[model samples]
Target: MIREPDGSIKIYVRDNRHPQVIERQLRNLDVRADVTFLPPGKDCREPRGTYLPDNPALLTSEPPAEGKDDYWRLHPEQIKPGQTFVYTMWYEEHGDNRMFTARYRVATGPVAPCEVVPGGPVMKEGPEGGIGD
Candidate 1:
């Protein structure tokens, strides 16, 4: 996730394997968003829900939405390995006090339906209670 100067959030999820579908589950206020699928062999640094460095991900010229909305659903048929999916939306931060969190599950294989990967440990809070690795 990349936090903007105006306090918005952009999320990037890369596909290291095959094509897949995803649902953006967000709460609070509605948001405007753009979704994209990057080709394979491309390089994108995961934001880890924080800052945006000098080198951001290479995306298509036209992002899906230039306005705000509540959510977006993506289903890419051929996200080929190494490709990436991106979502840029509002973060809706409260007055100096907001808690942000994230959890993801992935499944991919040659079967008719993908299997769910077991859940892992929850993220531990940082010393300062800020989002960090």
Candidate 2:
């Protein structure tokens, strides 16, 4: 239940308190799914990743699961040096959960980030240098 790219991670369980449950499930069941966006109605504006929709006073309304539209768009110019991403998720009994934040990595590539440039080929890691000479 950890998502990469733009969307957040989602964790659903019958009953589990500790956040480690996710790790256990992933390891035990071999749950392999690359997260790319907040699974509708799971994303929130809270500091930590968790959901308690029943208590309005406790939390705010979250958007429902969505597709790529929920993705956080990034452009080449927006990327900078020294950027390390760390996202955390928590799950409680009888409740839905989501990732605290989307993790991102500053991979060494063509020296330009082009997540929102629409068209145009961007640099990428190849077997040896770039394609051809």
List RMSD in Å for every model shown: 14.1, 20.6
Alpha-carbon lDDT, every model = 0.29, 0.29
- TM-score to native of every candidate shown: 0.20, 0.20
lDDT (tens digit, per residue) of candidate 2 on 1-133: 3333533333332212343454454334333211223321243232222221322221122443554222232222222333212122232212222222333333222223112222222223246433311
User: Looking at candidate 2, what is the lDDT of residue 101?
Assistant: 32
lDDT of 1: 0.29
As a TM-score, model 1 comes out at 0.20
